[model samples]
Target: MTTAPAPPTLPRTTGAPVPVVPSRGAGPTRLRALDGLRLLAALMVAAYHYGGRDGEIGDAWGSSPAYQFPTASGFFAYGCLGVQIFFVISGFVICMSGWGRPLRAFFASRVSRLFPAYWAAVILVTVVFALPWVAYEAVSPTDALTNLTMLQMPLGVDRVLGVCWTLWAEMRFYALFALCVVLPGATRGRVALFCAGWTLAAVVAEAADNSVLDIVLMPEYAPFFIGGIGFYLIHRYGSRDTAGWAIVVVSWLLGQHYAVSRLWHPADLPDAFSYRPSLGIVAVITLGYLMIAAIALGKLRWANWRWLTVAGALTYPFYLIHEHLGWVAVHLLHQDLGLPAAATFPLVLVAMLALAWCLYRFVERPLTPRLKRAIMR
Candidate 1:
């Protein structure tokens, strides 16, 4: 659900870099590579969930994840950094799509794009868990309804899908950006100011112990999104924009600090691996930032393959259904069907991918246009 608020982006027009970014109602050239990168980020998160985790399975596995796949668990542990990657990409894509559009267009795109697939996934996962063969307890109807609104986090309701905390973060970012920046005009001057103000507020939000501020400001995640917007600015404005470079650098520094702090003192996730958290965290997040910067600078424009748009379309649905449903599938296959972890993992992943494609093709594709027209009207 953290995918951008735009349609499948158009192919990049071949030419030398245009020094001047079109400011009024003109979007930047479609970076097909961003689509592929988003799929990579989603897969990274999937790896962390499938391969990195342990002990929280509630007997979902015969053996713990670490014991089930000892060698691979070490590597997959670092995949938790994928959420940070998604936010950075979200920042860039949201900025690109939001530029020069009216508030209505922005609203329609986000609502239409996110809700259809999310609703489908919520129903699918909820029903799967409630099956007679599945051992998991289903959430109450009240919570299920709230989850549909995608505001379950702030309201203190549990998420139907565990991964949606990131969506809550994405929603807050969009809400603030729409109200504070896009609603007004989205000029270069205005966007820069929005970044500046958000950054400052985030810093303050970090220093305080206020839970409300933490949730609202998301000091932990603001930098990645801010950095993404900065990268978009660089893409739009050109290489000479000192302020754009500064935003990316500062956001990167803050992101490194926040990431290191969060990942270092982590406890409670049993057998989660001791993979040199500090060094590995820095390297992984640095990779995300560098990828965005490379795209903005047009260094990776050659990734315009036709298949990436399909990959990007599957990201949201795959992410939505992957967590609990995947756990159940693995348990069903490995424990009940007597499949090995090696086969079960790949099988479940493939099954989820197939389901994602089905939902994207049949569910989201059909619902998006009607949703857009209803809202746009």
Candidate 2:
């Protein structure tokens, strides 16, 4: 079964004010509350990583008697759902902003926003992790150059920074979005087109057992991006109808209970767990649709909600640095602190917040724009 796409939180205009930046800043951007959503999503991802990477939750969830239950497994294996939310939000915003900009301008802005911080993180990872283990296996100059250029994935190269995979994916998405902008008739359909086309592709992908499209030209995770696009379109043009909501809710329930589990795993399970036209997947997609609708149609003011937005603003850095370091920190502290994962989760969260903020204020913010200028020149 296909996974449900994420809900759109990007704005759809009803004569409301919104920030009009270049590509990827599209839809309604003044909705900083979505920033909060972004932050929340990133944090959830961080939590999942912290537990899983340290072999705490995965080991526990998979076998430990105390952590047998899904809920008790630690940050909810489902908490990784946050990544989908981020994708949905990114698609909506990027499509909206990039739609009107020239290709040169669009690419420049994206490169500017994305790369500097990434390079800095790479440098940090090398110094902290790579240098210490030089004799064990050092990063060759060629590998370093591959990573620096963000062509590591195509070359089948791994980075000193493990989290760089997502950046590679995001960069690919940007390239795809650029194609949409350049196509003569591409602007006409907007979200509906993206959602329908992605759904069809996803169905085909499932049949082919081909995951390559997603990593390349295709949206690696169509459900999330399509979900975001679907929500954005509905907010702009669809009615305040409850029909879509019904589909979304049902899909959400079904997906949680059956689809996500089965979709992610089938070989381990019997024929009973094999592919079926899951209403649960549809429900999940529909739910995302409703969320996007709520944000886009509701009002620009709606996006300005507090803490989540603050978190959203910090999400990128948090995501970039948190996993490896935070995972190590949480585990080393877990036994010593004698705290349950639940009790200790918030401390990890706070530490991530602090570190992310410091990275932004000190490393990313200062260097990103300057790097872009230098590169584009």
Candidate 3:
């Protein structure tokens, strides 16, 4: 359930389309394809939350989600893998952005990217949950305010939207990267060691029973970020990095175990919905890896289209606004208004996408650069 900022797209040209590779001399060249890919990951997460489960999908929608989205539910069940994909993308983009920059600039970049839409989301969800008829749980005003800082999880305050847990994971990743890698200046050797050492440290933390380390390191999500960093090394420095490939392969192998382990221990589901292990889980995870590898190798250079930039712009806001507010809308249309569950699904999806676009266009686009300048100054 983690999310990340979209990578910037390469500028389009008037001449024949040439593949956009990383500059290798100055700053890293942005990949437009990855920007488009971020939107897909957000959509997958949204669909999974909306219609992926069985048994009333939260007891708020009045019917089984499997019954609601009969055909798509099975596929949506695997949508959690989208989080894995997001972390990988996060690794690549963060490394690309952080390379050769001081910690203040990196911190500013992350703050400007993450906080704008997240603040809006917390405010909006708090207002919505305050309405008496809503099905989602309402928390104390103090809890809601704490949620605004993205620190509610560690502070023992209830998350306004359960999906915000991923943001917490993402924030931790940024903190780790800042303090450990960027503090020393992110040279290639340092980053490679950080990726490997983080992997080994996760193991040590787990076996040694250190709760502080467990909380800080987030063992389950670290490998995707490691693999992503490795992928970025290949993209930035070319494929000659044996260390990069080793990091990717090691992370992929560990990623398999950590990812699939969740299948049997799914949180908050009813006892009736058994979590059976499946090869499909592994396949989807592998597919995510392969997709990142493709981008790292420049195989997706032709994907540099302009609209995908718009798609990237919409992704963070779309992800922020989708989950809890979406379910409320679902109840209104399907349960209150007597619409068919199947019919309601697309209607709600289209509505969420439109809402995301409005938020991005009206608020995020204009405000983000100013926020960045302020933070940088």
Candidate 4:
């Protein structure tokens, strides 16, 4: 009848771990795995340019037996795919960063994030690498001015650094995303619709052979970006939406088509290796899907390491500066100084990482906050 004595009341522990909740309209609090992924992608690109087809170091080493490391050589062949990974990551990160922010704040944040580090790389590469090592004539005053805007290609001006061509696509994506932000409601459904329309427009433009549309749609790369956005929608709203999956599937198909028509068609491949755009397309698609799957499965949710984020922060500067400078270093150390390719390659990589760290610490970190304040004000 006493109903087993009253259960003792337990005291609440104030020190219990608090769950980190995502802010309204923001992405998951952190994606630490993406940080490591960014570093890997950047390194892949560097290796590709250094040792892959028509690579600077590969060309300089001149069939030196020491330079023929199978892993490095084999990996370089697919290094260009790293840029595709970057575009997908950009789509996701940009959405995460801009979510719930006003147009002004988003624009300010983007400009702060991009311009300072970009400008530093441009100036440093122009003055140190291009002027002294590569083509002195190429580093004209107008080139410097054009490069500063990060719109050199669209403006019909040559890029200051060869690697900068990707920035144009990135900028275009930002412009298109900005358009979506300004639209009425600006809901996830509307964003998805916009991405689908953009993909369709890209396809139609390519089919019609419209030059203007080619510029506007950027048909070759839009699908990858669209796929990224599709993944974001799926992550945010869950997989119940069949439309999201459909969009991702359509984007993948169109992306492969574009890759075949645009990239592989014009590429000059080695005789032993026949042109196979499908390989690159499949690789990119696989990586993108894997990233989404990892997120959905909560596999990478625990990747909240601080060092990974630091590496991710260094990726942009490393990417911006590594290619040209690494080439220059190879020319100086391997060719001129008669150093072994084995030694010179690793040395150059280490030097590039050191320089990137400096740029991130001195230029990007310092300027970003100040620029954000100035622009947002």
Of the candidates shown, which would achieve the greatest TM-score relative to the real structure? 1
**CA lDDT of every candidate:** 0.79, 0.54, 0.77, 0.69
lDDT of 4: 0.69
Model 2 per-residue lDDT at 135: 25
Model 1, residue 293: distance off in Å is 1.2
Clashes of each: 0, 21, 0, 0
141 Cα displacement, candidate 4 (Å):
2.0
* TM-score for each candidate, following the candidate numbering: 0.90, 0.71, 0.89, 0.84
Candidate 4: tens digits of C-alpha lDDT, residues 1-377: 11111111111000011122242243545555677777877888887777765534555665632245555665565677778777766765665555555677677767887888889988988788445455333467787888998888877786767778888888888888877753243567777778878987888998899988888788888987887777666655566656667877887777767655654643465443323355765776577668755763346777777777677778888889888777778777877899977798789888998998998899987888898899978
The order by descending TM-score is 1, 3, 4, 2
Cand. 1 TM to true fold: 0.90
**Number of clashing pairs, model 1?**
0
Q: Which residues of candidate 2, in runs, are more than 4 Å off?
A: 1-29, 52-71, 131-145, 182-186, 190-195, 205-214, 217-220, 237-289, 306-309, 335-343, 375-377
RMSD of each: 5.7, 7.8, 5.9, 8.8
Question: On residues 200-227, what C-alpha lDDT tens digit does candidate 1 reach at each position?
Answer: 9999987887888888899999999999
